[model samples]
Target: MRLVVARCEVTYTGRLSAYLPEAVRLLVFKADGSVLVHADSGGYKPLNWMTPPTVIEDGDGVIVVRKRAGRSEDRLEIRIGELLAEVEHELGEDSGLEKDGVERHLQEALAEQPDALEDGLRLVRREWPTEIGPVDLMCRDADDGWVAVEIKRVATIEAVEQLSRYLEVLRRDPTLEACRGVLAAASVKPQARTLCEARGLGCAEVDLGLLRGAREPELTLFEA
Candidate 1:
């Protein structure tokens, strides 16, 4: 990872146009050719980012990040004013973060009882592979339609977006052209729910306890 603190202005042009006036910010260049511009605020989310499969060129004093997608392209032009600090680090061999506890347990339980997602839903396979990555669970709906299920401990906007991407790829398959997507989580935020509805994706609140074989308390009534 390479981190640079510099005074720069950024402009992005693609489906939309955005400009960041000259200011001091952090520019992060990852090993995968991804670039991120971060303001002092906004927590972890970068102010702007260009993902991998991109090319970054340093020409004279300016930096250009370009990505080509067939005939179209997206570009981020950064005009550097002054470089405050620059540092590079070599972090070798990351095993990646492991998912544990609820999210992991939930996925396992759901895989065993796919119908818990929807009536008559049968598990076609778990971790169904795709070009992007493996989907959490792939199932067949009542009508035998393909359904891609993404399980999250807490369903947020990010989770919805992730499921949307999977749907995009899954639908490209002729056999699964009509594939549907479902976002299942223990709790879903309102914003996430809205996004799911807007995308015509299904959202289900999973019962973690129930799926883990926890039964409700039995009620005993005395004669009255």
Candidate 2:
């Protein structure tokens, strides 16, 4: 990650135009290919920012970040007026949040009663193998089609991406060529839901209370 405190001007052009005239601000260029411009007073929010999967072009006193937004492009241009302070840090690979007691218990419950996530879901295996990592559960649906499941207490965009990666690897086999993915979690975040919907991945939020025989489980399975 690179951090710079500078007097700079920022302009964003995409669906909307935003301009920040010359001012002293904090600039962050993350290793994940994201860029952010922050003003001292905005608390945590950046004055301008761009998410990952971006193209960055840096030149003398100027940096531009570009991302594809449908047919057009979203761009952020930073023109440095004066460089105040600069620093770069090598942050190691992130150790992501773990599945706690609740998540583990949720997995055990779902594994025991796979139908609680989707009507036709039948457990085939747990810790299904792949090159990248293990899938939480592998199952067969009503039609006996393979379904790869990733269990999380709170599913995020990362979870959706993880399931996507698993599906990419699982679909290589002729027998599992049609294998799909489902993210079963206690809670699914909205952003993750949107990504899953766009990618044609399944997102199911299981109510532990309802799944534990508190009430008859009515699962809504996404058909891919």
Candidate 3:
């Protein structure tokens, strides 16, 4: 991941047109080929962003991101006035998701048998992409409708919010506009359940041991 603090202006043209005037902002160029421009005060949302499968041209204090969007192209241009702190970090393939051992294992287990969460639920893919981030899993229901699944070690309000964001972006695509979200976790909080119900999302408290054949993974070498 490359983080650059710069005084710059951003303009986007594609499905729509938007611009951000010159100011000090944070620009993130991710290993996944995503680019994000953020202001300091907007909570966690970026001011402008472009997702992966993009070609980025950078030189002479200007950066241009191009993507082939169907019959046309989308472009994001950044004009750098001053480049401040710029540094890159090597983050592994995790992509800031599935950070813990148990969560990672649970995702793998669920990926193998998605029907454990719901009947006829078969995985289309894992780490399904969106602008905000990737969904834990993308699946198809018995009716062949799109299902977006998010697995967490513990489900909270924030987790529900994360899944909601993924769903929002996915629904923008005409093919996935009817998509729904499901949240599976080792532990699902009451507040999270309430939020899921209100948002019309499904929630299941996944039993990790049961999913793994009634045996929890051995994380330690020594027996107590």
Candidate 4:
């Protein structure tokens, strides 16, 4: 499988140290699990500050997306510094950053990361040129069957909505007779569970404990 490694920084005010750990830890775990990449936050040591994600603050953090792929031309690497500055500017956070605001900004920025396909598995960003719209991941099995993936860092009904859209797009392809659907989230929203059941989609709640060093499971059969 292709792997990418990157390091960024966590900058938050002392007020958020408690919640910051959970957020950052979850972010690291989700990133690593999704991309098969190593992720680290520049700690408080202050000994060495390098690269784009070298700074963050309360309601704000910096992250970079890197890729290790054979097709260098297609591979995309996003510098954390650039993304951080962009997000900061977009959010207009000149003063103290709000936790919710920062989190939302980073999440939106993360969607711009690079993409790579390996071992029948693919890690895709928002910009991948896919006929099936903006897909999070496109998995192809040995039988040449395709599965559409949609991810959620925190559970929300939107996960179901996003995957539902992908399924609709996949249905347009005659080759995709039956496109499997997936919802990977840290927590499962009640509405999402209901939608998954009603729509026959596979839903999985991801956590560091479940995916620390494990590979994403293959989607064997369609639900219902």
- TM per candidate comes to 0.79, 0.57, 0.59, 0.38
- TM-score of predicted structure 2: 0.57
List the RMSD of every prediction in angstroms. Answer: 4.3, 7.4, 8.7, 18.9
TM-score of 1: 0.79
Q: Write the per-residue lDDT of candidate 3 for residues 115-167, one digit (tens) a residue.
A: 99999999999998777677889999999999999999999998998898688
lDDT: worst 10-residue window of model 1: 91-100
Find the candidate with the highest TM-score and give its number.
Answer: 1
State which candidate, 1 or 2, has the greater TM-score. Answer: 1
Between candidates 1 and 2, which one is better according to lDDT? 1
The better candidate by lDDT, 3 or 4, is 3
Scored against the true structure, residue 188 in model 2 reaches a CA lDDT of 95
Off by over 4 Å in 2: 107-115, 118-205, 209-224
Worst 10 residues of 3 by lDDT: 91-100
What is candidate 2's lDDT per residue for 113-215, written digit by digit as tens? 9987788889999888775567999999999999999999999987897798688667766799899889989899999999999998989998887878778
The sequence of per-residue lDDT tens digits that candidate 4 reaches over residues 1-224 is 22223233333222122112212121221211122122355542222111111221222333433322223311212233222111111223234333354334333433332122123443333323343345655665445566666666665776686677567556656776587876766578888888898989877665433233345656698789
Model 3 spans with C-alpha error above 4 angstroms: 88-117, 122-140, 143-148, 153-181, 185-224
